[model samples]
Target: MSFLTLLDYASVLVFAASGAMVASRAQLDIVGFAFIACLTAVGGGTVRDLLLDRHPVFWVADPMPIVLAALMAVLVFFTAHLVESRLRWVVWLDSFALAIAVPAGTGAAIELGHGPVIVVLMGMATGAFGGLMRDVVCNEVPLVLKQGEPYVSCAMIGAMSAITLVWMELPLNIALLVCAAVTWASRASALLWGWSLPVYKSRPPRQ
Candidate 1:
């Protein structure tokens, strides 16, 4: 397989690991865990494909991602005890997954002949929406939409930067590296510094 294809598979596995982390935390049964993990790993990609009018979606075409995600779910389920107290580990894993996925998603949009805005939006969606879905399904606030942190904004910036690099005719590998770095650094900074968008607050009652 080509190097890009290998990277795509790596992104899949990383995203699957993040999903499995969520499933384990939710204390789901084996089948439920696999289902949630697979859905969380591929849900965003599937949505992007449908939006871009790309048929067969990605995991559907390969089937390997699903199988790998299921395997990851099983492994994580059995190994949950080891990391049960390490919530930061889960956050970092998810951040890594998002970083890997951003470039892959951008490449997919470029392959589909999407314009820069659409391509960046699609990439950000692919990197973030699955986690949003997982959080919602788990009855928790969706991380991307929550205040007091930089989340989807990081994905958006990374994807848009990648699209800009592509428009500037940069090499694909270099563009991807830049984008992934943007994602990872943004997330890490948010975690370390508590960076977040300002939230609107209603004023006190007027006289």
Candidate 2:
């Protein structure tokens, strides 16, 4: 398979894993796992396609992605028992998904004529939002929403850097590699070192 195709498949698997992890946490059924997996795998791309006026969206154009996501969800659902730790699985799977998705989303947005600013936003959303939705649906605060890590911010930086490199005529492969590396590093650092952006809360009225 071509590199792009490989990236797509990797994204699907990772996203499916993210969703399935959340479903397991929620104690959801198999069907619920599949639903979350499919949404997490394709939701961002679906939104991107719609915004870009790209017809048929991605999963609609190929049934294979959905099938793969569902199958993977099933595997995760069944294997959840054998796994000794849930948090480890969720974090690693989410990290993997973010690494694949930021580049893919940025590339797609650039291809669709979006500028650097928009591409970065799209990339960040693509990397983080589906899982955010899954968390919200499960009645938990989304990771990206917390003041704990630089998740979406990392995605934005990587996407913008990639888009800038592309604008300067860099090859797609090189851009993808560089951006993916930076994104992964930033996110992993946040997770491992407890790095976070500063929160600037307004002081309460003098009491």
Candidate 3:
């Protein structure tokens, strides 16, 4: 398989893992696990494909990603008891997924003949929207909107980095790796150190 195809499958697995972890925390059953897993695995890519007008969608064109996500959910269901910290595991797993998916999305857009702006937007959408959908479905605050987290920002930076490197004629493999590294490092640092952008504070209405 090509590198992009490999990244797609890897992102599906990691995102599915994170989704299943969340389902476990919510005391969801097997079907719930499967639903969340599939959603988180394909939500962002689905959106990106639709926006880009890709026919049949991606997971629809190839059901392997869905099957893989369901299988991952089953594995997580069976092994959740062995994990002492599902929440932490979900965050870390999501960070890695973001790293992979960002480049996957950006690369897709680039291949579609889009310029850098769309490439960056598609990359961020692919990296962050799936998790956003996952959290919304799970009834948790989406990480992208959460305070003291740099989720979307990390995705944007990674996407831009990849696009910039490619624009500079760097090897695609090298660009992908460097972008993934930037995303992973930024997200991991945020999770480990509570790093975040400043919040906008609005004044209260006059009493």
Candidate 4:
């Protein structure tokens, strides 16, 4: 009903679908799909809530998120074979999830009156942790740790965008909209235009 609640549900659905896609890639069963989907749907939010000391956590407060995740997993489990590339589906779905989640997190921290740095960190955690957990549990390389990707940068920039807008006295909902826009655009650019950060290169000393 509320903007923050909308963001949370949107992120959960998209993230759950992404997690199910990963399960499809791993050839996991329906139960595995539900497990991974629920994990990925709420993992970041759970971490954020625990760190912020939100009572009962988000999912515990309302179990609908978990039920929604299971439903999404079921849908994906039956439909995954139709996708040309499950990996691409996972990445793209995750991009959308990250976009929504970063703002959701930033808004939550801001609502709690946390400072800007904490806001940004919570946003990044919300955008990244779910996918990281999904990948680790699926025995895949975590997307957050992938070389040359700007995932974390996108999250930080998204959160900062919200902070800037709020500092200028813009409405929180409007700021969150901007946050999601920037987050998705940044991630989409990386996927579509090959935008990336430079990775470390090692060289022999005194060569």
Candidate 5:
């Protein structure tokens, strides 16, 4: 069990839980919960793998991630109503998933000898795409598309931070850990304190 594989599994589990919460909010059936959960778990990595031409998508190759996702879906389906705010749970879980999955994507790109740009792009894709898909399917606003939030930026910066650490000749494992920490911290700040980039304000035409 390589560390990267473990990252994938962790992200899949967390993202699946988040997806199931969204399904619960939508009042979807158990099957719908599983469907949304599995989609949110693997959609991003599936995109990353396909774009990178990595033979055999991660979930397709091992299927443990899918199984894990389905199990998480079942758990969340039964317990979601216990939460007073499923939306908050979904956000926090998705943030954790973003942190884990971004590092996994960066590591994959780095291992493949891809340049920094590809690393950053893959990281963002892997961290955000699943949630985007889940939200779109569930008719919720996509977090990545939310105004001013640093969602995609968090992934990008996290990947670049990993690259910087690697360039300093640090251990790859340490770099990945830093990546996860940076990504999660960025997201947490946004969620907790409303940290965000400046958005252009629309104004009436001046005379």
Candidate 6:
């Protein structure tokens, strides 16, 4: 199997785990767990593929992601209670997924001969939109939409860094590793230190 293919599967697994955690917290049934897990696993990649005009969609082309996601959901359903902090665990898992997915998306775009701008956008979308869909369905604020969160920014930086390194003739595998490391480290730091971007301050209207 290709490295990118492996990355894709890993991304699906982590994202699915995050979704399952959310479903567990919501006290959902097995079916609910499966639904959310599938959604989170493929939601962002689906969007990226559609936007790039890739036919048959990814999960349609390869059913392993679906199966893996469902399996993860079932596993979490039985084991969730062991996790004392479900919400926190979900966030970190999603971050790991983001780290993998961003480079996966960017590499796919680069292989497709897409330009830098499209590559960066696709990378960010792939990393973030899954979590966005997950939170929306779970009735919680999406991390990308949360005030001051550096979620999307982290993806962007990692994607751009990967692209730049590739442009510099670095090996694709090396670039991907650096990208994932940068993305994960940035996100982990944010979570550990409560770091966030500056929010807009609206001024009061003058009388």
TM-scores for all candidates? 0.92, 0.92, 0.96, 0.97, 0.97, 0.96
Off by over 4 Å in 2: 204-207
lDDT of each: 0.80, 0.82, 0.92, 0.95, 0.94, 0.92
Q: Could you tell me the TM-score of candidate 3?
A: 0.96
What TM-score, to 2 decimals, does candidate 1 have?
0.92
Candidate 6 C-alpha lDDT tens digits along 72-127: 99999999999899888998999999999999888889888999999999999999
Query: What is the lDDT, from 0 to 100, of the residue 39 in candidate 6?
Result: 96
Per-residue lDDT of model 1, residues 1-207, tens digit only: 654456567766776777777777787898987887887788778888888878888777889888988898888888877874645666888788888878878878887788888888888988887787877887767777777688888898899888888889998778888998998999888988888888876676852
Q: Which candidate is the best by lDDT?
A: 4
Candidate 5 off by > 4 Å: none
Task: Please report the TM-score between candidate 5 and the true structure.
Answer: 0.97
lDDT of 3 by residue, 140-181 (tens): 888789875788999999999999999999988889888889
Pitting candidate 1 against candidate 4, the one with the higher TM-score is 4
Tens-place lDDT digits, model 2, residues 135-184: 77877678778774677888888887798789889998789878888888
Worst 10 residues of 2 by lDDT: 1-10
Model 2 lDDT at residue 16: 89
Tell me how candidate 5 scores on lDDT.
Answer: 0.94
Q: Which pairs, if any, clash in model 1? A: none
What shift in Å separates residue 74 of candidate 1 from its native position after superposition?
0.7
How does residue 207 of candidate 2 score in lDDT? 32
